[model samples]
Target: MIKAQGLRKTFTTRSRKGTQTVEAVRGVDLQVGKGEIFGVLGPNGAGKTTTIRMLATLIAPDAGQAVIADHDLLKEPAAVRRKLGYVSQAGGVEDIMSARAQIMMAARIHGVADPKRAADDVLKRFDLTEMADRPGRTLSGGQKRRVSIALGLVHDPPLLFLDEPTTGLDPQNRANLWDRIKQLRESGTSVLLSTHYLDEADVLCDRLVIVDHGQIVAEGTPAELKRGVSGDVITLRVDGLETAAETLKPFAREIRVDEDVLRVYVDDGEHTLPALLRTLEERGIRLSSIALDRCTLDDVFLAHTGRSLRDTGADA
Candidate 1:
């Protein structure tokens, strides 16, 4: 339902020194299949939101081209907007408006055939029926978020752009939203989601691209991406982490040290553990604890970016 090629955007900011150019997005290419939930997975400042903005027609790209629902993104932006719904990072709802009022207003703006009926249906779909009369300011963060998404669905667009949809929701609310997103896909609504949460991408996305520093480093299903990292992860708690890192470097496909712990990624953790232990004993290093687990999306991020996803900054 969406295709983008070499989409690029740059922003110039004024500072005390002078104006500085920031490449918020660089040659970002994406494709979201009809009825698929595609994800743009990245840490903050990785251009996920910027890419979404360009696709949603909220911002124009400095270069490249895109098509949304068969409409030209540059030449037919209004048509593209008519075919898609956008729920931004903040969920942008009026705090003083009641949930019913907010959704009905959006319905009217979208020219829904029956604005009141559309608003009522959306409220019930999002399980906000009981809170329909409550003002946005009176709702909890999760309830307000639901209302925001309800507003987006008032138009019944074929595609939805959800940028950090679960950013500030509690675990329960996040999970609930996941269910709602899944239902959307089942009902044939193409969803393009941008999120930094590894678990969210793992569980929610049918396919995803891992973006970093304004570029795509990897793209695939969560399992396919994790498989790129090679084998199990063995975390060892030991003294002299630096020395242990170097000592086990040859046996490990990859090694990272955090304080007194060493995380070793290798092809065969069970076979390598005995050899590692023997080597440590020979070097007179004390081992405190050791554990093995399957590779995770974070490991995939580390392998591709050379840094943990959680370490990225908040701005792109």
Candidate 2:
């Protein structure tokens, strides 16, 4: 149970001997229902982390009203901290300490009555029992990430904040972490996760808010966001894309030509692809590749932001 209204945070920095203020998070309104996994999706420098820091009570917001599990964040920060757990991008682990020892120290700091028992339990749950005695620095990247998660959950807080939980992990490790996050939600832990991984949000989030330039641009379930596009997407890569594009103009609801790839938006991709292929063949265009699929969150983003997620540019 977390809620925020008109949440904003700003910071001042010196650049080239000149001072400038950056509005990291501006008027962010977020609500996380009990036991729900709410996701914050944004690219780098999009204020997702800034909003999370404010919600965790680690940083004060410039203007906002926030409540965490019945405690006002601005008025009762200590009470809010007792009810929430935070796992940062840096993985929050001491390199020299063993997993069990590290978690035990965290439990003790949180004033858990049975710190030893709690540490043992979390180590086992996160599959770190075998390496519980090993120093954190000796653990593999995946292992260290899991240990960080275990530390965050050691206190058994009802609400959890995970900022880029699987940032640099391999695919296998990423999936493993996703499973653990899902299990937490199933066990009634309200999770607020910020991730740039589109597929991760598509698979794990129940509801998501897309943030850009320190503001929420869109909010919906994955299906709702995809459906916002209102059609199938047919992608064709052919030599002489400009000529093929001119020929396919009559059939296209919306056409975008990027390099040699021609992206056509239509009501039915199955029907559109055949006609598109026929037109290309008639025009003697050399087809390189063709891919047809339903719309995705990336498409939704491209539609709203006028740029692909993977576009290479200084702004992206």
Candidate 3:
């Protein structure tokens, strides 16, 4: 439902250091299939939002071409807008307006045949009926978020752009939103979600692209991406990190030492741990702790970017 090629955007900002031009997006390309939940995964400032804005026609790309629901982004922005729904991080709902009022207003603006019915349907679909009469300011963060999503669906668009849709919600609400998003896909709405949360992408996306420094470093299904980094991860807190790393080097496929922790990637963590412990003991190496875990999306991110997602500052 969406295709983008060579998308790029740059922003100029002034700081005490002086004016600097930041390349928010650089030649990013995307292809989202119909009825698929595609994710653009990245840290803040990694160009995920900029790429979404360009594809959604909310902002023009500096250099790129895109088509959403068969409408050219640059040549037919209005038509693109008609086929797509956008729920930004900071929802645009008015604080004073009740959930029902806001949804109704959106339906009316979208020229829905029956604004009230459409609004009510979406409110029910998003499970916001109980809070429909509550003012946006009076609702909880999760409630307001649901209302925002309802507003986006009021027009019955075929595609949706959700930029960090669950950034601030608690775990319960995040999971709830995930279910709603899954329903959208089942109902044949193509969703392009941009989020920094690894677990979100793993659980919610059919396919995803990892962006860093304004470029895509990797792209695939959650399982496919996790497979890119082989083996279970073994973390050992030892007294002599360097010696421990050398001792395990022969058995490990990959090794990373951070502070006092020696992390090794091995084909079989459970099988190797016992032998590794015996070897360490024979070498008189004292281990404070040891852990074995399956490779996760976070591990994939670290392999691609050399940093954890949480370490990437919220602003970036």
Candidate 4:
């Protein structure tokens, strides 16, 4: 229920030398189908949060156009705001208010006639009912995060923008929140979430767009993206890059050697392993460990962006 075309945002700041402009988002094109859970994956400072802010009507784009829930973001931002529920990267709820109070207050501000019922419904569905009376300031980080989620969802808007929805929670709490997000989508809420966790995006998103340097580097289902990498990955713990590189040259489709390991990409690791072992044995290259597995999102990212998400230095 969301579409953005040629979206761009730039920020200007004064430096000691002169003013410099930073392009946070550049010509980004995004589409989220109705009732679909779409994910934006990137490392910190990749403009994921900036894109979300622009979509949520919290920030205006420097260029391009967007239609959120059939309302133009630039032309009819008020309507867009009415249709979207935003959970920002920074916390949104009050510290001292209880979860129930926070949600109820949000509903009232959003013009919901029955704030109590709205608050109760969200609390029950999000599994915050037992903790409704607990003060947000006194709650655990996960609980406070849940309260923020509840506040966003209290109005039951058709479109939701969640930035790092499960960033700081424990595994169990993260799983619990995932179930609730799934339920929201099943009930026909369109969600667009931005996250750094590849495993979370793999499990929770129907499709994803990978962003880097404020631009989309790749977009696909997790499986499709993984399969785009052309071979199996073999991790070999062999000392001496020069020796391993020489020994592995004939058997590997591509060879990348670090200080004490050689990563080989090949069409057939199972068959290639024997040849690789024979070459290593013939050359007397000592091997400590060998592992073969299919490529992952990290590999796909490296292929596209020449950098891992973990290495991207994104602060957000």
Instruction: For model 4, give the 10-residue run with minimal summed lDDT.
Output: 307-316
Q: Write the per-residue lDDT of candidate 4 for residues 146-239, one digit (tens) a residue.
A: 7887888888899988999888788888887788889879999999999988778888999999998899999998888887774688888876
Runs in model 1 deviating more than 4 A are 246-251, 257-260, 268-275, 313-316
Q: Is candidate 3 or candidate 4 better by TM-score?
A: 3
| Best-matching candidate per TM-score | 3
lDDT of 2 by residue, 1-316 (tens): 9889999999999989899999999899999999999999888888989999999999999998998999999999999999988999999888898989999999999999999999999998888899999988899888988999898999999999999999888999899999999999999999999988889889999999988889998899988988777578888888887888888888877788765588888888887778778888888989888898888777777777776655622122
TM-score of 1: 0.93
Report lDDT (Cα) of residue 252, candidate 1. 87
CA lDDT scores, all candidates in order: 0.90, 0.88, 0.88, 0.85
lDDT of 3 by residue, 1-316 (tens): 9888999999999999999999999899899999999999988889988888888788899998988899999999999999999999997878998999999999988889999999889988988888899878998888888888888999999999999999888899888889999999999999999998888998999999999999999999999987778678898899889988998898788888754577788878899889998999999999899999987777788788777676786422
152 Cα displacement, candidate 4 (Å):
1.0
| TM per candidate | 0.93, 0.92, 0.95, 0.92
Ranking of models by TM-score: 3, 1, 2, 4
* Best of the two (3, 4) by lDDT: 3
What is the Å distance of residue 73 in model 2 from its true position? 1.6
RMSD, every candidate, angstroms: 2.3, 2.4, 1.8, 2.3
